[model samples]
Target: MPLPGQQSPLMIHWEASPEKQMDCQQKGKNNKTECFNHVRFLQRLNSTHLYACGTYAFHPLCAAIDANRFMLPSHFEEGKEKCPYDPARGYTGLIVDGGLYTATRYEFRSLPDIRRNLHQRPLKTEESPLHWLNDAEFVASVLVRESRDSPVGDDDKIYYFFTERAGEETTSFFDKSHVARVARVARVCKSDVGGKKILQRKWTSFMKARLVCYIPYYEVLRSVCSLDGGGWASTVFYAAFTLSAQWRTMEASAVCRYSISAVQRAFEGPYMEYQDSTRKWARYDGAVPEPRPGSCITDHSRRKGYNSSQDLPNSVLDFVKLHPLMFEEVKPAGGEPLLVKKSVAYSRLAVDRVQALDGRSYDVLFMGTGDGWLHKAVVVGSGIHIVEEVQVFRDLQPVESLVISHAQRSLYVGAASGIVQVPLATCARYTSCYDCILARDPYCAWDGRACRATATMDSTGLVQDIQSGNKGCRSISGRGSLPWKNRTVLQGDDVLLPCDQRSNLARAVWLLNGSEVLGMGQDRLRVGVDGLLVTDTLPQHSGEYRCYGEERGLQTLLAAYSLTVLPEIPRSPTAATPPHAASQAANDMKVAYISAIVTLVVLCAVLSTILLYMSCLEKRKGKYVLGEPRPSSVELQTVSANCLRKGHREEEEEEEELTYPDGCLRIIPGEAPTAATSPIKELPVAVPPLPPPLPAELTNGMGALPNVLRKMNGNSYMLLQQQEEPLVSPLYSASFTEELSKILEKRKHTQLVEKLDESSV
Candidate 1:
């Protein structure tokens, strides 16, 4: 296989990229074995060396590893069947002391070669148990019983789990059942590594048994850890199953459990063999091979100088390959599941056995699903059920593997994109008893302030003791000295009474005046964001308000408060005014405004009338001036002395020449000198004091005196003619013409002045 002369071929290496990465990049190089497919992590034996393989690589390199990295000599690449490079192929394997034992195809150049040190694949016979692997998926593998566990220094044995098609389908070409099951356990001994000639480098004791209730839909639902009953006599394996797109098995998905005890029994029972006469395989009951092929080899074999399968004969090895499968079908532990669920295809699983407050133990299973949700389930009475489902992957990436760290109370789930670290339980968020009880998780218990996980317990069934509410803080915590809650709001303003509650399951009750508050749908009073709200606070609203939490008909005083409504302060005058005063002022101004306008108009008219009347009276008074009287044709007669004396007989008569305003006065000789005896009633006019008397011939004889005509002291005006008066023409008193002064002098408040009429000559 090496270049004829060389001892072994060399693997070129550098710090650059791996050679396999280039294989996938080549355009013309189209081969399935060109690149590495699966990688199984082996241990680092030392600082300089480790064991690994680029399973199904172009050169089939093996036993290669390093931190920076290195490749082993090509000579260790025993066969291509050990590790395939194609991604579509799958296998379960382990490495120890440079020897590899696995359940994989035994082939070279696409041809079958059954004479290998390990033979995990079954025959193609319709009745063969391994015949199911024809179209099956290999789930996972792990070492079960090691040589150190045996006091006699026995060989190491590994257990493999998988799922395959049912045997009935192998017989019918068309009639096939889609239903499948968990192909439980298959084992191969370490010492069975083949020796030189017959069955060389092939397994001598490879056998398979059924494991109960495991989901084998995946190629490898990796096994993190196993729980053992003391040693290997009884054990359980926890696994996750994902619903594949190619097949629809169940409407919902689930996580399944398996037991090693069931698998061991299935391997020790009768084997199904082919009956040539009937052309069918029947259950074999005649004889079983000696040395118990599936059992571990004790030190007694070593005492007989037998170490590996190479020490055994070819006839015994040939018999083992023919009967690789046992007859009995396995069942799950307790005849039921530890945890089961639906609607979520669980693809990866990690489990922990924990103690609860009820003094009982429970298995807490963390299962990852294809839908990106992580389901947490617990083992409860006769069945497994989900406690809660959490969304771990926001982007919906598929979960490929899972790892648990019990010390940190976390599970690390890995995907192609990244890994997420999730806590086993987040108990602090649920602080109330109603919230804690409804969660139904075994790890959480409501403490005084939060939901806490308690690890110390003396009894087995102690999980059921958790029940309490997160209220009545003063009483429950024994610290009632806390200050009283108080609130104040102005009247007619919206107010919110706060009662912040942390528990989602508990109902908050608001109390006002020692009675229940109205429900949320009411106006003015309602349950708002923080707690209760009085949309409009009034003076009557000032009272004690309280909030309580109710759970299981039990009450807890959550908070208490004294609410006081302050009276509203008045606003400034610019903002508000008395309505009554404002209306009265407006009315008064309206009336006064109208009245003043009317009085101004009337006073102007009255003043104008009085001025006109005064001007006319002055003009008419000028006409009454006798000093320049117009020449009248009427005859005047002088009164005799006897007549004047007789007219004045009743009074003391004086013979005095009285010069009157003779310009208009005329007398009749036969008439008495009184005003009533006169035929014409003359109008009286204003007169100034007489200046000097004139001759009787030059003026009318009558000198008049009327009570209606009054005299002023000397201030006067009159109509006087400005003609040259001849000295002999009887010097008349020219200054006394008789034009009235301003028509009427200022009159007294009670004065009644006589009216004068206009006249024409």
Candidate 2:
């Protein structure tokens, strides 16, 4: 109920109904309500009251937010040259010595004059150069600059930034730029009150400068850099520029910074005078004018009796009138642009210097657009990063004005409908360290408490290792993933694994049974937009399905799924079918069984009848035969070798000692007819030999054959009774235990016979 700092509360109520004025209902229809229009508490005249002005709505009303009564000068905008009443119009204002320094047009459309949308054109008048603002001009921002060298604060100057109709006419008629719109700025010394004569209540030293970049209007941000020894800091104004010319327009809105010193030199530099022959403004190479026009009265000039423009000669004033604009186009800051926007028109900008965690200072720029969106951009290592885009207004109306409260770490935006306040830092919204670090906003820091903002221009303790990528998050080791989920699916069915990591800064990878899965070329395995979808699952598909986030060479498991695939159940024929189908199948199978049993019975009876007929025929055919051998039949039996030629005995005789007549010994008479005995050489067999001998019973019932004279697989070795010890003795005969002596006596007799036969011969 009270002002920001007050001992007592001020009171207010809804004023007399606007229609109590019907005229009041129409008050805000075109512009804004009188009570809420750009109200400023100009000064505190007393404890109970204050001096204020709502320049656009209710002309200079001195009232509180809820004040029941309001007061102001009756002729605030009553005169034609005073403040404008149109809410659609804009202005720049400052208070000094009880008088308001306002720069804006005083007329557009009045209530009594209802007209179509019309543009204001500069009117030619005797005081044209004094009220320098052209028609159809819009005031953007106002600033008060003080001289750092001077101790007196009253020596300050006021600057108005805006866009207005350019004096140059284009080739096309009826075009928006037929009267080209150019970015323009005007500044006036605060010390100049006015001339009491012809220029009463008008500015004396009003001058302007052209800001070049892409498009110029609306916003002017200051760049202040500290210098050594702290004599004075340098300043620059970063402005945005654009163009409507289709042929030569900028590709994007370009932001450029112009040195404040250059702006001053341009104002005090050579002038651009009108050339009548070319009907265009050309540089004036003429000699400089005396006393220097359009400059504030300095300490040195005041002693010379020329403290203000009114005291200056007409020659200086005429020269200033012809060259109110600077001759040189201020060069922009080096680089492509501080910011570029192709389609969006940046409505307002507020800038602040931030100290990063790496101990570097960064300039953070907040630009508001006509689409009700605010873009927070941070200067990071030779590049600009837009950390976040916040939608301030619901209706997407143009963000008309912006203010930065550095002390509060908050931003206040003025829109077409109302004003909104928001925090300057949104790093807290990022729930994870990865997200917060990836934002690269110098104004934001984790700070271990929350994502807080630092106001110091040179600090970086919040994110010292932020440039090392996720190293800033290496200390963060908590889990935010959901609890492990268990899922069961029947074989041949499909399954999907959920991946719910919200940050896009990480890549999601799928794993099965602790092994990475190839996301591509797998018809059954793939990653979907929201999760991993596995088609036609098999038994091998049963395992732990994990989703891991891969960011900057680090892998983090985000979710796990214990997936189990159930085996298929085997069913009987009937069980495999529905109840209705099963019943029908049972009936059909029963009929098949009965038909099979009947066919088997008939087949058995037929086969039995055929067998009996065949048995009867065999008995009838065999009836004439007796149980004796037939007369015409003969039995061929195998005869024993003993009943044959006894050829085996000849083989026995060959082994006996051979004898011969001693015909060669007759020549030796003295030897008394010695027997000429020599061992006979056996002749080789010429014919094919007969088969080896078989035993007597072996020839006929050889199954019962004995071992006597048995054919031992073609060798006639004597058979021995099998002894307790089974040993193979091929060279040791079983009967040769005493046969060695017989052989010695037989050889002695043969020798004696040979000697006797030799003596007889």
Best by TM-score: 2
Q: 175-281 in candidate 1: lDDT tens per residue?
A: 23344433546676655655346555455666765544434332223333466645775567775544434455653454456666666677778776645687444
State every prediction's TM-score relative to the real structure: 0.50, 0.55
Candidate 1, lDDT over the whole model: 0.53
Task: Summarize candidate 2's per-residue lDDT along 198-304 as a digit string, tens digits.
Answer: 34444456677665554333223221111112222255455655445543443345555555566666677777666678766667788876667677777656777
- Scored by lDDT, model 2 comes in at 0.53
TM-score of 2: 0.55
> In each prediction, how many residue pairs overlap at the backbone (N, C-alpha, C within less than 3 A)?
29, 28
Q: What is the lDDT of residue 170 in candidate 1?
A: 39
